[model samples]
Target: MKSGTRHPTGYWAEEFMRPHQAFLAEGYQVDIATPQGRQPVVDELSLSLGYNDNDQKSVDDQRAYIAGVAALKAPLVLGKVNAADYDAVFVVGGHGPMQDLAVDPDIGNLANAILSNPKKVFSAVCHGPASLLSIFDKDGNWLFKGRKLTGFSNAEETQATFAGERVAEPDATGVPDRI
Candidate 1:
């Protein structure tokens, strides 16, 4: 999953992309989706690249997904997506999630549809987990209520960016109170 040109970096992006490879290798078909369903961008600032660039494991497993996405040249843009068709959904994270995923009505709708489907598995990582802002029911409660979950920790955000990523106040983005 991607949002705002879902860039393919940061701890979260790397985590989702690698498992994506394994899922593909095991014969599971995966589709990347994003708000606006546009191409996703990688935040070049994630420091993992500097030390790990040439390391074979890091190169093939992680960068391969980035290159793989690049080869496809476009994502399925989530805004136009139909979630009923997939058995699982993952939203990859970057600085972009706070910028885009949190407020898209479609993302909230997609998350609701996916989580409501009993067999479907939904997951996100790093700031990607911020996509949860959209996962609500008609009553405006999170669908994952009482379910164990994880998300971007304040400490992680502090470590990932040079300056604390200054998210505009929530009202500015129109995302819900929790994002």
Candidate 2:
């Protein structure tokens, strides 16, 4: 998040794990990928007691689950992986992706490959859809132009940013609040 907020931002825990668990449960071989093949930073805020509805067990379980996943320890390099080798490309959502995945040309190429293949699936959640912005057709236009897509919306972003912060009431400018 380029906004003035100093809070550390990274991939949301549930955004990455829930779908991953579902894929594994269905006997799908999951491969984690990163722009540099390194383990991604987890947003500690997402695991907080407040965020988890005060469920300490859920936080602990999420932490344990991540710690035990060997694939996360050494993910595949996005630039080096062959898109055809996988049946699906799932970009996990986070503030971090907006920094790298959304702009990386390698990711753009990979996304295009995944989209061109009918048998392959391309899916993302929350901020994850931002990554799709990089995908373009051969003519250099956005691949999903005019297509309905979902992602972390502006309203949700506002709520998340001010979740526990105190702010002044809206002024007469009709701009609501400034970042």
Candidate 3:
């Protein structure tokens, strides 16, 4: 809901830009939510236009995304929005998400809701999928325990950044943490 910061670990910048633009153009109302409801800092490393340079289509898409983000309605306070309003949920990735999304009960709950429906698309990239680890079935078992997913791998995060390692990416597959 706020600006993201430059992270100790690296984030795949193009991945973040891609879906943000997709959702915006699909006519799906977009919202940025985070724990604590303050403006989260963007990871400067993830925002480098040079490093994550988009292709021509991607560039045009991002122009739309920038406009959409600039014009978004007031940030939805994560704790207040209900899940039913959304048709699908796409978690945007960044090292910043590793710092909070994993433990956010609301985000976890949202994942669970979206996962409950096979028709719904519950997706993410980079470290954003870490939030999936927080979700559980009715029995409290890990909901994404076996779901195919992607995340910022620890090796990817460590090798690409000043930060040697991070807890956000699980040691196993790009699946969620509870696995």
Candidate 4:
């Protein structure tokens, strides 16, 4: 969660919920977590019907799915998570992550621990990738330095007119700078 009530885009949350639903259907237990184990807020713009991008059903489904999940109301504390207990880590995107996850040392440690497992898969989408900025290797370099990845780019945000607004940005530089 962000320091205050900052939140991620609603579309990003919906995108995450799709995979979460799939994993659950496949018998994978999904746990909602945050740096401080607080309930996450969703950006209002993301919930708008226009933002649904002509797929209102998807948004509706996501809302229904979220309503059924009790864990989202009060997630587990990220620092308390044992990486070994899960087979993978999925970071959901939203501007809110840029506010906290991007600079949170605990998130970096968690990512490092999860990535250290050869059998575990790590994935992030949209602004969710901002969390990657926190992970550093023993050499104090970015853990994902040479890896190929993509996320919400600054150009896109600029195109969307978020450049000078109050919207949250990443904590780093370039496409993934800190908010």
Which one wins on TM-score? Answer: 2
1-179: candidate 1 lDDT, tens digit per residue:
21224334433446556677788899988777666656666555543556467465774565566766652356677778788788888776676765587667788888888878788987776677767766678977666555655666656555644323354233433333543
What is the RMSD, in Å, between candidate 4 and the native fold over all Cα? 4.7
Sort by TM-score, top down from the best: 2, 4, 1, 3
How much is 123 displaced in model 2, in angstroms?
0.2
What's the CA RMSD of model 2 in angstroms?
6.4
The reply for model 3, stretches above 4 Å from the true place, is: 1-14, 53-68, 71-73, 146-149, 162-179
Q: In lDDT terms, how accurate is model 3?
A: 0.62
- Over 69-166, each residue of candidate 2 has an lDDT whose tens digit, in order, gives 88988989989989989889998888777556777777889989988999889888887877876777887777766566666667687787633243
The list of candidate 4 runs beyond 4 A from truth reads: 1-11, 54-58, 146-148, 164-179
Measured against the true structure, the TM-scores of the candidates, in listed sequence, are: 0.71, 0.85, 0.69, 0.80
lDDT-better candidate, 2 vs 3: 2
Which candidate number has the best lDDT? 2
Clashes of each: 11, 0, 12, 10
Models, CA RMSD each: 5.7, 6.4, 5.9, 4.7
By lDDT rank, best first, the candidates go 2, 4, 1, 3
Please list all clashing residue pairs in model 2, or write none if there are none. Answer: none
Instruction: Kindly indicate the candidate among 2 and 4 with the higher lDDT.
Output: 2
